[model samples]
Target: MTAPIPTVFIGGNHEASNYLRELHYGGWVAKNIYYLGASNIIWFGPLRIGGISGIYKSHDYLKGYYEHAPFQGSASRSIYHVRKYEIEKFKKVNSPIDIFTSHDWPEGIERYGNTEQLLRCKPFFRREIENQELGSLPNRTLLSHLKPNWWFSAHLHVGFDAEIQWHGEGSTPYPPADPSKLPSSVPTYPVQVEKNQDEIVLSDLEDNSTDDDSRLAKKPKIDAGGEITNHNEPGCNIPNKEIPVYPPPSTNFYGDSETTKFLALDKCITNRRFLEIIDIDTGSEETKPHTFYYDPEWLAITKCFSKYMSTAQGPDTIPSNIIDEKNPDELEKAKAWVKDNIKDYRILDNFAMTASGPPPKSCNPSTNLNRFNRPKFNDTYLYRNQQTTKYCQMLGIDDPFTAQCPENDTVSK
Candidate 1:
């Protein structure tokens, strides 16, 4: 049976690490469904979509490790957190975005709208919301950076909406100024200014290329005279040398700088109001006005994934360089290493079979685990504390969100 509307999703903190690893660049999950990866932007007709997976964890952001089977304790967290590399790419293409999605809510986003009504709706969050101690710090920072028209999120298991208003002067706060407003000027000498172009030049050291190790096995040898020579050539007696490659460019992490609106969905599996559909007007019309346009900055960001992203491959086999070597002992040793470290690759000929079967008619409230499954408060508090301290130190200020989440008598100490 065919469905009425197409569906798509972004990864949450509890994503299937192996599955996502299989589709790093976001392969199709079903006939018309797709998964948005760690960092990406795509176009559906005229609508431009951008998304970043996972929640924000300080440690996970630091170590953006690739997925491996026999998942470790931090495996889930590592796969789902917003990594420094992803954020760096966003900063590099610093421009306006259309629709953005993250797993967690932005920190202290309550003040952008009616917090009193939000508290009234969900009394259980009275303590956290009133204290301005909910949501994610990294998400808040990203929201300010990528000022999208509409933001969608999940993982907190409660559906809420608010308009995060950006103020004052900035490219993000308002739409691009009317080009017609500029004064006409006399023709001047033609000059060229360097425009930003998208490029991904990965170093050998940081290269996660599927065949990188194989290429390394056949790397040319350097002779004493500083000349690069092949060891396989006749009369060549120099031993093969291993060169230490340098790491990728260091990424700079910055804080939020603008306002944005957000709509966080509840637990889809166990909530009656699981789905929240947003209607966006793509045309420019009054009352039904739609200001969305083709964003080149966002287009540049998506290109990063298109040209250089990695592809999931089968089990590790000995490189052809090792197999084709003249020596027989080298082949045997390589086989032994593979036997000890590599497992038989699981055949996933039909990758779409991994998709969740289909949507249920309704979520049973009797089986809901909201009470027992609430996230820890102290953990959230500690994260906010760390973020606050870091921003304060960086900005040389006592408080970073003083203008946003101001101190009030009713606020928690």
Candidate 2:
């Protein structure tokens, strides 16, 4: 049987960590279904899609993936939290992105959309919005760093839209000459700029590739530094590095200053706007309409940094001085390696059931556990799936999540 549509998803706070851990490099979870891994950049036709799975928790953000199944205490919950290792990896991207998704909304995003209406619809969010502490801070940074044409998120459970216009320091987001014509409810946030903070360069995206999608076309050369404002300077300590920063693309398919469209959706339920069909123009560059490939640069970054992954340890293994546009040799070498090693870049719609289904309803052979099973606090066994082994072998990197599970002890978390 064949599925009607293709679906790709990222991890949220709640997921089957035990199973998801197997395809850590992102693989077909099922026929027509793809998991985007911990953090990844995948290509669908002319669209370059990238994202990081998991929500944010400052403590677990830098610890790497150290939790195992039969999770104890808060391990099950904390295991799905976002990590710095993945966040730092995205900072290495130097190409234009078409779409980016995240499980949680970016922090400070409330300022860009109409907060008052959001509060009216979901009043429970008022406290968090008022305290200015809603959404993941790291993801917010990634949003500013990788200014994709379209950004979609799903944590807030609301139908909202906002346009973020990337502008220089002295530029205004909108024309100040006509405040009277602007609707009061147009934004729940104010167009104010942050003052007096150290800035870090995110990308020096210098691509000259010819594509019909103006957003992905050859970008004009500009100054070599772009800055994303840092709000929560406490829990987030962005490393200072020397990377080139360029302004948003001068030409856009929409025919305006380079901007990103942000949308957040609720869960699909009766009378809820959870499902949205977005229409996009792939330009004249798409070879196939229903195919996706690996982003060469992202693959390069992944292969280059795969050795630094921390599956069962503290501290992020990826060095602070990671490769960026300034370091072209390392990236070129990895890209070259990918071309030589990865025979087919296309992501085939194929799935393999490498393991058995969950214990058939509680840990009992008679029945399996429910989504909210009683979490164990001490068992920390790891299962190495054949999918992960092959993925690592192909990438030429050591498999990080290879702890052995006990014999005859077949309980899935």
Candidate 3:
């Protein structure tokens, strides 16, 4: 009986290298091992940096030392050229090469509408959209010539668990042009050809149907119990009142269009000393706002306004008049309301500050701020104060005011 054909998996880049290393170290001693891509050197270079010359040298070393022949190929090169090279390479070693591997989709797969998006040749808004189809490129001259029984490739990050038959003669649905008007490289060859003058039948495998939309539909559903489930379920009619009611639509202030406008406005603010209060918590900070350091309370209000400007601008912008000067109960209520509703503010003090500049020498909290000629409310100072307040709050210490020195007091050397 013929020995079971050895199988191996190969991929591209550093990820493949790490995977191969794990396989090698895990005692997987398969006689056939292949590395297909440009990044193999990234993995093997460190092992034999000065000692080895090329990939063949490393392969030979592995085979001689570890008793496993290593196959290497560059998928970037022409598939036809690589196939020919592989056949010749295997012939010299007198090894029967049964399988082919690559880090790229076969040519026909690239023709699938979805393949264009995989290569980022086009824009894709949602990840769920199938931008290309599978097995659409086998008709290409290079792939057709090589014609491996089972072609293995990745690069798309898609899974085609089921067998995909090649439909070479089918018309492509993209570019929305007539195929007849397209120029052919060469005359199509007849499928019938006698190798030893013995009649052999070649079946036409192309499925010529423009209705490929069905092939691109969502995959069959599987139930939570891991069994195949019917997707057609009867809809249950329930009272509309029983359904959860959603709140009225609210507008986003820092969305793409607004963000762009804000950036431009920030540039103007940077020119003037008018403060720009940024909500640092949301990772949205304007480098320049219209003045010097503004009050944190004002900054919080600005953030809230920016978040729901459309809604805020519509009549109910300001809250009902409520005063709590010395009333402890009202002050506590106001503090809670501010904390819950307001976004924390951060000031962009130095517009052109850099690490290499004459400021922020060390971020150590205990560093003497007086020695650096930095302002009392510099980023470091403010950050340190914030941290102290946070620590005190976490420790259930209600008096954060004691942790902070007078805000206006400058440190004197």
User: What's the CA RMSD for each of the models?
Assistant: 29.1, 16.2, 32.1
RMSD of 2: 16.2
Q: Which candidate order results from sorting by TM-score in descending order? A: 2, 1, 3
Worst 10 residues of 1 by lDDT: 237-246
* Highest lDDT scorer: 2
Query: What TM-score would each prediction reach against the true structure?
Result: 0.48, 0.70, 0.20
- By lDDT rank, best first, the candidates go 2, 1, 3
Please provide, for model 1 over 271-374, each residue's C-alpha lDDT reduced to its tens digit, 9 standing for 90 to 100: 22457555765442323112112223333333322222222211122334432344335334433443343232111123335323333447454443234343
Question: Tens digit of lDDT per residue, candidate 3, span 1-413?
Answer: 11154222343322323123222111122332322221111111001000000121111111111111121332211111121112211111111111234544443343333333222311221232342222222112223333323334443323221122333454332222223422322223322321211111122112334222233223444433555432222111110101011221111222211110011010111122122233222223433222111122222222222221111101112122211122234334543554564342222222221112333556654554443344333322211123323322422333212322344442111
The model with the greatest TM-score is 2
Candidate 3 vs. truth: CA RMSD?
32.1
Which candidate, 1 or 2, would have the higher TM-score against the true structure? 2
